[model samples]
Target: MKQSNRKVSGTLRVWSGVVAATLLAGCGGAEPVHPDEPFPQTQEQAQENVAAAPIVESMDAIALDRTLTSRTRSLIRARLAQGQAQVHQQVPVVSDSGQQLFLNDQGLNGDVTAGDGLFSAIGDVDFVTHQATQDRIREFQARNPQRPLMASTFDNRVRVSTRPLTALSPSVFQPGVPIPIFPAGITFAVKPANSLIITDASVINDPTRTYDPCSNSGNPNGVWTFNHLMREMANTYVSPSVLTEHWLRQWTVNQNINGWTVPARTAMMPYILTPWPRVGGALDLTRSPFKLVAIVNRLDLGGGRGPAGYASGNAGELRFVFAAVDRTSGTCGVRPFLVIFEYGVPHSSCDAVKTWAQRWLELSAPSMVLGSSAYNAALASLTQQVVVRNAAPRKPNGSAINQIRTNEEWLRYPWELREFHLMGSGPSVNRLQGQPTVLTPGDAHNDTPVLRDFINANTPAILANTYTVPTTFPTASTPFLGAFPWIASDTTSFWRATGISVNEARHKFSLNTCSGCHGRETKTGFTHIDEFGTLSPFLATGMSDPSIAYVVQDPVNTSLNREFFEIEMRASKLDSLANQSCLASAFHRRLTSAH
Candidate 1:
C-alpha cells in the first residue's frame, strides 16, 4: 500500500517555519535568541565529560548536511536545542552516538560562523562510538562471524531503536457516548497499568499460557498481564514452526553481569529482564539496576471484506509494550522490547472488529477496578475471540512486497514476518508484518531497493519540509493509522544514507519501523513505555525525557518537538472504532488511503 504524501495542515501550520530557524539559531528552536546572552558551556566542563572515557573523535567546525541520516541530524539538532537554554555561551555539541565535546560556531574552535549553518565542535567526524559500545559490537561480531559489522551495518541502515507496546470483543462492547477520544466513564488500562510494577519476572510468567491477555495474569497480584498472549504468539503464531523457547535468548551472557546466574549465562537467558531480589530491598523502576515495565492496549486495524483479499481479513491487534528499565546497566540486552498479538477482534467485518474495540474502551474505563470479576469478564469476552494461529501466503521477490513462502517453518528469525501472525522487537533488531522486505532490519539482501535508498538517503528532499512517501509501501490489510502503525534496528551508527524524512512521509514511514519511531523520527528515546510509576510518552502527553532545554525541533512533523502524546492518537482510534458507525468507515478503501 502506498502511503499518502499529504501533510497534516494543522500540524504544518504550527510547524511552518521552525526548521529553518533551528538551522541557524542552533538550539533555541522557535524561541528568539538575544544578542547579549552567552552560551554557558566551558572547555573545562567539556574535558571533564571525556576525562574518564576515551575521546574517539574530535571536531572543531561541523556542518550538518542531508547526507546524514535523520537520527544523527536530529540528535545533533536536539543537542543544540539543549544548549539554547543558555544563549550567548558556548553551544554544547554531542554526536548522535553520545560523544560530547566542546563545539560551537563562535569561530573560536574553527567554526566559520554561527549563522552559516556551521558548528564548531571538538569532534573529527559526524559518527563516533565509545569504547564501551565498541566492546558490545565485538561481542556480537565474535559470534556472528558471517555478518560483517561495518559493511553489513553500513549497507543495512541499522541502529538501536528507542523502544515500544493491547485486546477485545463481541456485541457486548457496543458503543456508548462518543465524548471525544477518551470517554468519561472509561478507564484506559494504560493509566492504571503504569502504576502496576513488575519487580519480579514471575509477574509476567504465565507458564501454563492459560491466562487471558486482556485481564491480569491468573495471579491475583498481577494487575497488568499479557504473558500468556506473548507466550502463545511467540511460541505458536509468530513463526511458521512453533517455538516453545521463543521468549528465551541463547546468547552467551559474559557481558556486564547484572542478574543472570552462572548457568543462565551460557544457557538461554531471558532477553526480557526484571529487577530481582531487590537486593536493596525495594526500589522503583528508576533506581533498579534492571527492571521490566509493562503497558497494554488494543488497536483496531480495520474491518476486512468478507474473507481475505488485497484488503480483506483485517482485524484489530493487541499491543504489549515492555519497557526494559535501562537507567541501570547490563548490555546482555536490557533494551526496551515489544510484542504484538494478532486478531484481537473478529475478522468477519470492520464493524465486528469495532464491537470488540468498544468492549476494550469499557474495560479501560477508570471506574473499572483492577481485580473485580467484571474486569475479568470484560477481558475474557475479548481475549476468547482472539486468533493467534495464522499462516503466510506465497510472495514474490519484489522490493515493495514481502517475500515469505507458504510453508510451516515459523519465521526462522526473530523479526521475519509476512502476515499478521505475531511481531516482536528484541533489544537490537526488529521487523514486522506488512512492511517492505527492503526495510527488513538486518537482512543484507542481493541489492538495496530504490525505495530503501530514498528513505535513508540524507538528501535535500527532507529540507523541503515535506516527505514523499513511497507508493510501494506494504500493507497486509491494516486499515487505520497512528504512532507505530503497520505494527512496526542495528548498531552499527544510524549513519545510513536511508533515514528519517519529513512530515507525512517521515511519520508514516519512520513510525512504521521500530527504529524510526524510537529514534529522532518522533523525538523519542529508549522506550515509548520507558517510565516507571509515571506514564510513558506513548500514553502520557510528552516526548521521551526531554529534561534538557531546547529540544531540537522535530524536523519531520515539527509539532512534537517538546510534547507528543501517542495516546491521543490511539484514543481517537478507539473512539472512532467504538463510536463511529462502522458502516461509514467499513467501505472499500484504496491501497493508498486505507491506512
Candidate 2:
C-alpha cells in the first residue's frame, strides 16, 4: 500500500519474471515468458492462473452444475428452452478485481465432457489487468521475496444474474424485470400534469380528478383510460384528505420537495415511477425494490430472521419503482430519493396478482392506444378494486407502522433513515438510521456514523460463508460501504450469491441503495432514468456492456466490475423465473374478485 513497498515489489516482480522465463525455457524449449510478466500476464490467460496471489490453483476447488441451487437449475433450463441464454458457467468465480473464470461446455476450453450440463474451464491465468489483481501479485512478492514461481486461481464478484444478458421486454420470449416506461401509454416522464412526479405539496391540480377508475364508471367493459388511471393514482396524494396527510406530507416526501422555489408548485417533484415485469408469480425477486429495497424477498434478508420473515411470503405484489430525478425548473433542487409502492394484489391472491401484472403488460405495449375504450375497460378492474393498506408509508409523529418495529419488512423511513440500506441480515433490511431519529435537516447524502459502524462490524462474518448465499451469522458490526468501494480484506472468499469477492458484494449492495447508486459511488448524475425518456450514461451504458472495464464510481469510493450489468441482469433473472414452472394454488379455488 505504501509507495516504498510498491517500488520494492516492482523490483522483485521483474526479477521473478526473469527467473520464471528461464525455468520455462528449460522445460524442453517451452515458450519464453516475457520479463514484464511474472505469470498470468494476459486478460484471457489470467482468469486461470494468479501466480502473484497466495491462492492455490485447484481446478476442482469449484464445483459442478449439480451443485447449483434448485432455482438456478430451473433458471438455466428455462433459458435453454427459450432458444437463448446459451452460456455455460460453473463458478462465475471472479477475482477481487473483475476477471471471471470462464468455465465452458466446449471440450476445447478445459471441459472433460463436452455435452454434459456441467461446465469446466481451466485457469490459463497468464496475466493481470486490474488493480486488485496487480495488488495481489505485489502482495505475493512481498510474502515470498525470493521464492520459486507457482500457479494460482482468480476471483471477482457482485452476485449478478448468471443468465445471458437478455434485452428488457414484456413479451414472454424476451423477458426482463423493469419495464422502461418509454413508448408505453403510461406516465413515463417525471413532470407535473404530463406525468406522475411524486412530491409533498400539490400545485397544479388536475381538472379531472378521478380517484377510483371503477367508481361511477359508465364504461360497459369496465375500464378507464391510461391517462385517467395516472391521474387517479396521483390524486390519491390529495384526495380523500387523510391519505394526503400520511402518504405525502412528511419524511423524504417532505425533504424531496422542501426547498423548491417554484411559485405555485412548492413541492420539488423528484421521482419517476415504472412497473416491474412478471406474471403468475414470475417477477424476479433478486433485483432492486425486491432484492435490495425496503420490502424484500426473504432470501434477500440476512441474519436468522430471513427464514422467519419468508415463512409467510406468499402475497402477490404490484411494484411501482420510483427513481429520484432532478428537474431543470426553479432552483433545480431536489433531495435524492428512491421509493417503491408494493401494491398487494387485489384480494391478496397471487393468481389475481398475475392477472394484475398481465394487464399492465398489455397496457405497456406501444401498439395499443391508452385512450381507447377497450384499454379503459381493462384498467377499471385494478383501479376500482385496489386498496392502500394500513401498512402504507408515513404515520403520526413521522413514525412507522408495521408488524414489528424490528421485523417489519414493509416500513418506509424518513429521508435520514432510508438514505442507505444493508440487506440479507436480521431485520433483513437495515435502514441507515441515525442514533436519535432526526428529521430537521434531511438528507445526510452519505453513510451516517450509525451505518458505517454496522457495515464495518459485519463484513468478515459475511465472507465466512462466501461460497454460499451470503447470510451473515448476525455479527454486531456488519460490513460497511459507501461513496467509496470497501473490500473486506478477505481476498480468497467469494459470495455464492454472485460468485464475486466480498468487496464486489459490497459494491452491488451499495449500488442498489438510493444514495449510493445515485451519487458519486456509481458516477451517476441526476437520475438513472430521467424525464423525457433520457437515461444517465451509467444506466444506459452499463446495461448493455457486460465486459466493459468501467469502474463503479459513486460519491465516496470506486470499485471494479465483473458482471454488474444492471438491467441486463434483472431482465435475465426475470426471464429465467418467468420460464420456471410453479405449482398452482387450487386452480379453481373461490377467489375474491375485488376489495
Candidate 3:
C-alpha cells in the first residue's frame, strides 16, 4: 500500500537537465533571497528579483524537481488509475474507541497511528472551556431524547433577499455590480425529509451502528450522521483558535454569572436572542445560479473482507460521499466519494480538522484561516511557506482546506469506478436485478459516476434529457459534468508531487475555484470577509428586523463577512434547538470569554 521510494526515469531524465540549464541561464546569476530577509539595496540586486518573482520565463530547479516528480509518478498513477490494482490499497477505519485502523484490499490490517499537529496530542485542549463545552454536548444529548437531529431540523421561516453588488462590496467587483453567486428568485426548502437530512438523534448519538442499504428500509447511499455534520460545521464555521483557546478556564469557581461554568451559564442565561418570528416564505434551490449540494458520509461497508470489514452487514464503515444535485436536467447528478483514506477518520474527523487549522493558523507565523486569501497566497509561494505533506510518513493528517484530498489519497472516488456503477454496465453491471439499466451511454473516461448513477436510478421520464460532461472549466453550461476539472485544479500540489504532465499540472493549477469567482481586489489585506454579500437570509427584510431578528451582527449590506457571521451565529442557535443542547450558549461564551 505504500509508495516505493525507488526512483525511475524515462524521457523526463533528459528534460530535467535541459530545464535546469534553461532556468539557470534565465536566472542571470541572481542569488536567491530568503523570504524573511531584507531586500537587497542595489539596483543590480533589485534586477535579480526575477529569480524569485511570480512571473518566470523559465522553470527553476525547484519547478524542475516538481516537474520530474510529477512525471515520475508511474507508481502513483498505477495506484490511482483504474483496474483491480486498487483493491489492494489501504482502507482507513476508526474503531469504536476512536482508534484508527487501516485495512488493505486483502484485508490485511495496519497499526493505529496519529499524524503531526494537534491530533498527536488528542486529549489536550488549549482552552479549559473547550473541554467543558464538549462535556455539555454530551449532557444535553442525554437529557433531550426528543430533540431532533441537528441535521434534520432546518428552519424555513427566514426569507432570502438579493442585495445589490454595491451594497455587498463597494470596494471591489464594482462597476458591473451585483454579481451574486446565485441568480435571483431561488429559495431553499424549510426542511428536507428526515431520510434526506439524517437528523435522528439516536442515530447520531450512537456511532457504532451500521447504516443499512436503502432497499432494507435504511437511509440511502449518501447520509451524514450528526457526529460528522457537527465536525464539518466546526471545521468550516468556527475558527480553530476559537475551538482551541479562550473561555476554557477552570470551571467557574462559584458557578457565577459572567464567570459561570458553561452549563451553569446555559441554564441561567436566556437565549442570547429570541428566535425570529415565523415568516411565510420559501426559496428554490433549483433556480438559476443556485446549485443543490448534498454531502453524505457513510460507514464503509468493506464487503465482509476481514477484521476491519463491515460491508455485507450493516456495520459502521468509513467513507464519505459528496454530490452536486443537478435539478436542471433531472437526469444527471454528480456524486463523489472521498477518494483518499477509505476510512473517514483522521481526514473528516473534527480533531484532524482542528489540527490542520492549527498548523495553518497557529503553528506558523502570520497564520491564516483555511480559505483566506492569505492562506492561498502562502501556498502559492514556495519560499514563504513552511513545508507540509499530504498523508502518511509525513503525517497522516489532512486539512479542512484540502477538500480535494483527505490525505495522500486523492480526495475523490475514482472516476472510472463511479462511471461504471452509473452505466450499470461495468464490473458489477449484473448486480442489478430490477433497477433500470442506463438509458444513455456514458463515457467511461469522461463521464462522471454520479451523473451515470442518476440516469440508471431514475426513469427516462424523470431523467428526460441526456446530460453531457462540461468541456470548459468552471462553466455552468452542462448539468451532468464531472468535477475532475475542479478536483484537478484543487490538487495541483499532489499532481506535481506525483510528477504528472505539464498539461495535467496546468489543468490542476490554472483554475481559481474559490476566490476567482469571488475576488475582491480593492480591499486592503482583507481576508475572505471582504467578499460581496449577494444573497443572504440575514439581508432579507424578515431576518434583519430587530424585533424578531436572528442575526446578531449589524448588517453592512455590502460585506459577505457580516452575513457569514450572522449565519454562523444563527446556525449555532439552531444547533442548540435541534439537539436540545446548550452548545449555542457555550459557543457564544467561547467566542466572547476573555479567560
TM-score of each: 0.38, 0.34, 0.19
RMSD of each: 24.5, 21.8, 30.4
Best by TM-score: 1
The order of the candidates by lDDT, greatest first, is 1, 2, 3
Report how far off residue 131 is in candidate 1 (Å).
65
Model 3 agreement with the true structure over 1-595: per-residue lDDT tens digits:
2221112223234444432221111110001111111211222232232111111111111111222221111110001112213222332222212333332223112111211000110111111222233444445455555642121111111222222111113231211111111111101111111111222233322222212211122221112321222123223334322221111111112222111111122211111111111123311111111111212122121111111111111111222232222223334332222221123122223233223222322212334433244533432232112112221111112211111211111122221111111011123221101110111111222234443343244322121111221222232433332221122222121111122223212121211112111112111111111111112233232222212333322111223321222232223322222221111111111110000
Total residue pair clashes for candidate 3: 25
Off by over 4 Å in 1: 1-227, 230-242, 246-295, 303-314, 321-344, 364-367, 387-508, 531-535, 542-552, 555-565, 586-595
Using TM-score as the measure, name the better of candidate 2 and candidate 3.
2
Judged by lDDT, which candidate is best?
1
TM-score-based ranking, best first? 1, 2, 3
Q: Each candidate's lDDT (Cα)? A: 0.29, 0.25, 0.20
Worst 10 residues of 3 by lDDT: 586-595
Score candidate 1 by lDDT.
0.29
**Residue-level lDDT for 41 in candidate 3:** 21
Kindly list the per-residue Cα lDDT of model 2 for residues 42-132, writing each as its tens digit: 2223312221111111112111123322221111110011111242233233221123344444443434345554334433111111112
Cα deviation of 76, candidate 3, in Å: 38
